[model samples]
Target: MASTAGIITPEWELPAGVQARLTTRAGGISQAPYDGFNLATHVGDNRTSVLANRRSLLRQLVGVRSVQWLTQVHSNWVVQAYGGAVVPVADAATTEQRGLACAVLTADCLPVLFCRDDGRQVAAAHAGWRGLADGILLHTLQQFPDPKRVLVYLAPCIGPSAFEVGPEVKAAFGWASGDCFIAGAGDRWLGNLQRLAAEQLLASGVRSISANTDCTVMNSERYFSYRRDGDSGRQASLIWIES
Candidate 1:
């Protein structure tokens, strides 16, 4: 596994040769707001800085041959990322080929990582409210031969205490009240993206699940939160198998 300054390494006991890491807002040359380690090219950051940050991140992963980046559209589309090319217009990606890593960029939105128990396959997803409601997780899980053998890691996201949503957002999930949703002022609600993901994964028969409790909105020093700071950088959650 790779380690950048303050990079969050998932604590799950993954199968041998399956490695994953969640990047934080630490380590890099991007300017203020993007400040230290901004890995995204969009959002008005300089291309040079973004590229340099990405290169710095890649250097930490010892055996990773290539990383398949994605132009996320907050949709349920899942693509097979076998080559080095970035999967365009997709929010989720999976791969069976070794040495090719799959990654998703996010700032407050949930980034989910998936791996099969045998370490032959891995996937990554960018699931905001819209993608989550539209079943991006399900779409990613369907790529695996057996969903039951899949293990999931829900990376950092906006917690329920900080993620305020309207009634339509709650209605989209077809739920009025649950542990994942908390009623707020008037018709507003606070939604837990992590819990919602875990519930959906459980319902799909996936038994091994690990999640980080870090709330991006609450932890501005360690993470980048879109809701808290508009026009911010995006961190990444990546997963891959060894060659």
Candidate 2:
């Protein structure tokens, strides 16, 4: 794990040469509610600031490949990421092309990262319950040949206890053969986003896995959470090739 300092952000290189990094709330420039380093343009944030923040990140990672961002729709559609014209309505993005980075933005939704040990390929998926239940993880896994060659990392999001859901959410996963949920407060249920993702990754053949201890709801000072804030900023979790 590399320190996300001085604009390089936190870049983590697995034994296989695959590298990743997650942005912090401390960097960049945005306003209140979206203050500090907020990175989403669709969340009612100032476009100028969002662009500047993105520019700052690009400047910091100069000489490396440009970051390939996606327009996510909380769906299960995964697309090949080659710095080409980004497809509309895609929820997950993957890449075998180096230099160009793969990134996903989220406030409360899970930002899942995937990579083959050889470091030749990497991917990022934005998975809210809607996408997760739709088999986004499973779909993303199809891009990689060996699940064991892949590694998984979950980003900050609403915690299970904080993630309250209705029958639809439960039934969606239930129909997918997922058994990670349990009954909870009122008519709601507690869904473990990390566990569900982990099981799905393992089911897809991932041999190595790690889940972030960070929770967007709990670590508001460190990340942005939509569940905690009715409308708030977004944090980006990304992976790129090392120059």
Candidate 3:
């Protein structure tokens, strides 16, 4: 229930010794456009600025040992976060080891966090439209011991009212007549990614679910949105096991 420097701690009823944080576009030293706390290094921000922002964030995380960031190619690949410090090119990461962090960077994409009910494991995934439709969350769930015992948190992202997509996107999920989409202009439709994610999680036997209802595209002052602003810094959503 702690909120500081635009960082949002997960509001879920999780197990003890597990921690999660979602950073907003505040509290960092990045300049215009990326004005607040931009933690991403690949979004045209100065390397020094990005490093400093990261340092500022890491400082607040009192006992977190290390964070494992991924390349995030928008695919369904999931990897273990305990494989040293080399950042892997994957969409999701999981870890059973204590002190290791599983992290994901996103501007408009969903940052989903997972932790076992027993507090023995944690994971994070970058779930954009492609990744979600391609089964990124499913892949992440496979890494856990049991889907029923895992708690999931869907971090902020583009909301249904602001996320209009082409027919292909809707067709990808095979939901010809579901609440996940609403008819839009011509061949386009307003899609609800969060609802789709929830449905997917339910189909995969995941029962415990929580979500951040904030919309990145709608909340310009608090979040960064790649869909709203073409060139923007990405926010980070991370989860870790306490040592």
lDDT of each: 0.88, 0.78, 0.89
Question: Over 4 Å off in model 2, which ranges?
Answer: 1-13, 84-87, 175-179
Residue pair clashes in candidate 2:
4-9, 4-10, 31-35, 65-99, 147-205
Question: Candidate 1 residues 151-233, lDDT tens each?
Answer: 99998899889999998999888842388889899999999899888888898899999888889999988898889999899
Supply the global lDDT for candidate 3: 0.89
Off-target runs (Cα >4 Å) in candidate 3 are 175-177
Task: Put down candidate 3 lDDT per residue, 79-169, tens digits, no spaces.
Answer: 9887475778999999988877788999989999999999998899998999999999999999988999989999999999999999999
- Candidate 1 TM-score, C-alpha based: 0.96
Using all chains and alpha carbons, the TM-scores for the candidates as numbered come to 0.96, 0.90, 0.97
1 or 2, greater by TM-score: 1
Order the numbered candidates by TM-score, best leading: 3, 1, 2
Model 3 / residue 172 / CA error / Å:
0.4
Model 1 lDDT, residue 137, Cα = 96
Q: What is the number of residue pairs that collide in model 3?
A: 0
TM-score of 2: 0.90
Where does model 1 exceed 4 Å of error? 1-4, 85-87, 175-177
